[model samples]
Target: MGKLACFCILFFNVQLGLCMAPDLSILIVTYNSRRDIEKCLASLRDNSRGARVEIIVCDNASSDGTANFIAQHFPAVNLIRSAHNLGFGRANNLAAQHAHGRFFLLLNPDTWVEEDLAAAIVNFLDTHPEAGGCTPQHLNPDGTIQVGAIRELPTVESLFYQKTGLAYVFPRSRRFGRYCMTWWDHDEVREVEQAGACLALRREVFQQVGGFDESYFMYFEDVELCHAVRAAGYKIFSLSYARVYHIGGQSAKQAVSKNFIEFYRSMCHYFRKHYGAAGVWPVKIIIAVSELLMLLVLTLALPFSKLLPPPQAWSSRWTQWRGHARLLREVWTF
Candidate 1:
């Protein structure tokens, strides 16, 4: 849409004004997310009723014919096909090329957006000039705030807390919970280091930083991109005003049975790229040894998993970490 047309459409409430062409491009990457994609699209339609929203879905060679299904069902959404699975960031980058919106909202295929989400986030960013990106608070399938979606940057101490299970053991520690930022209620808006599940940024930022590093096949790429955004002097904000129900890890969890080796690999790449001459070998070693420790602790705790006095949320995290350790055993190269 033209500049005047874009503003006129975005500035009015859906009830008061007619929805026109999308001012925000909703970018999604689909990799065998057959079960989740249908609801996701429906949610977009219902929640975005009065907004002119551009919906784009990039199918990464899914075996389940996810692309064709989307094309047949959601004809208004732009569908892009790839010969091979392009990982997460690559596919989004590919779809972004076709975007005509003023802002880009990178969404996961397994998420449901609230009615005001598109308007709230876009309006907030439009008013706040320096904010490079904004992310909604992620909701679980049960509608509670999802933990670990927002956090402080990774540090030796926070990594220690997470790897050693101290974060679970001490759920209230601001220091131990640094990486997860567990103390905060998430009811207020704030700046954060990472929020990938449902994130938004201007087209200029996407062009300025480029797509995620191809080396990070799936994970940690978001964190790396956050680093780049902040390095460019743009703040990353968490939108407490909006939310999305994220199924979380529909695609990544499929590879968890083999152990999240790809996930770990991405983590190593991120550390090496940002840490300079230090290289990844050291990070690799720490991760390997930490996974070993995690395996031992969780194995011992398995029998009493139900008996633990810790909050259910912490137990959920421990279960996830256990899966991480299991994958590390098979995928650990060094």
Candidate 2:
């Protein structure tokens, strides 16, 4: 269709009330999130002043009653229930299929919204035409501002620092901790490379770059998406004034071992996908070295396990790293 013809069709559709996009479409992909969804929805309802919003929840085959709970309690939600777990990126992409809004907000089901979050973000996007997406300040459950809310794109150097414990050891060093942007307090509105928790993007950004990379499955998908968004000439921002409280890691808390593997696996895939074939090797090597370092520490600590204040911590650490060792072996051979 020609641009004029498409515009006319859209105009007529809106005029006749047949098709009209809301100001914001909130997408939440829930996996066993029945415990968190209610509070999340209630906060959106009570907050989000002066913005037309539609909530869509894609339930990724939750064993818990998440789909049923949304269907019963939140009739307004456009709920799409997948027959199997589609992971984070794919599940959100599935939910976006039903989204009709000027902007799309990717929110976790465990998040609580602040007053007028949607309206404020809508206004910000409206004014800042150059910005393709923005993230509000993320807060922890205890009401402290979350660290690593905004960050630089991950590089091989950053990955090495992160995986080898150098980032944690020298958090204030800009070179060592650049991945987490640890040197700066995240209190100002500025252009950022990635939004860690919640992200809101203009509809056109999706139309250009499409949704999160499905291959990611879970982690680093947002980073890939933001990279694509920026590469497409759209700037992203951290809107520090607006805020959302995140009950982080609700889903990952379910299966720690599986989640850990997926985290590294996705990281490796992300490096390869964006940084080319050679990128995967550095990430794999960093992970392998980290695992080896952990093994060394565990071997030294094994004799003193009983003397540790929490004796169970030593045992859990051993169990955790045992899985990591297996993962490292697989990575090397694969």
Candidate 3:
């Protein structure tokens, strides 16, 4: 009878060990994202394989029934509800604190993954030890390739060329124009400098770099993180095998004014950190003058240009300038 009890105890321990095995954790930061969160969760549930994966929803005080809906429908999801909105970087950081996986997928609530995406990314990273992060090719709802993956960081000149449509004038010159690789039809996998929409990182690398910088409230956080990862002797890659669909602008559309303001502020933060105040100051002044001139042109042309529809576009530009102006003002005062 004692021998029989020992055998049963051993069997129970084995089962417990199997059940406690760690898995990849998908961390999603959400705020009033009821419209697309369901679809996002459904995609993850369908696609995840090989790894024991867990979904974590870090909700930033979503009042539009986001929390209750996830609790009812996605009972398997680990929910962390914030008392107030902590913005994107902080919210994702909150979820990462509780992750138990070897790797972590920082996903947006409005993005849907393909069935093989998670597995493909895992395989790629497994083979490439130097790769710090992997992101799939993102597609718009209309099946067009979104330019989320890029080879170079946008400089002040690149921004000016892209904004003024001068990039189109010198299409082939890499130095004088934007070399977006927008027309490239190659299916080959390539190393990328940035991946803003969807990215997966090794838990170790994330810890080494200390995760996303909270100084950046929203925009350019991914770029900054990528820069840090590369500086730490890691590579960032864009895998062609994996794919995801991003319902772009969900968060931005919700709070248009605030989002624009925050985006410029984040950009300034990035500029100051990477480039010296002397270098960024000239660019800021140029951007301010160019934007004001564009706004003036749009205001005057509002009566005649229906095809161009300058007012709305111009207002958006003006808002961005105003945001940049605020950042410059703060920096100058400091």
Query: Whose lDDT is greatest here?
Result: 2
Off by over 4 Å in 2: 1-13, 16-20, 303-315
Model 1 C-alpha lDDT per residue in residues 197-246, reported as the tens digit of each score:
88898889878988576666788878877788788788889988688999
Query: What is the Cα-based lDDT of residue 165 in candidate 1?
Result: 84
lDDT of 3 by residue, 293-319 (tens): 655664565455555534332245455
Each model's lDDT? 0.79, 0.85, 0.76
TM-score on alpha carbons, each prediction: 0.83, 0.90, 0.85
On TM-score, the stronger of 2 and 3 is 2
Best by TM-score: 2
| Predicted structure 3: lDDT | 0.76
lDDT of 1: 0.79
Q: Per-residue alpha-carbon lDDT of model 2 for 229-251, expressed as tens digits?
A: 99999999988789999988788
Instruction: Please list all clashing residue pairs in model 1, or write none if there are none.
Output: 22-52, 259-327
Runs of candidate 1 exceeding 4 Å displacement: 1-21, 277-282, 295-334
Error of 3 at 188 (Å): 1.5
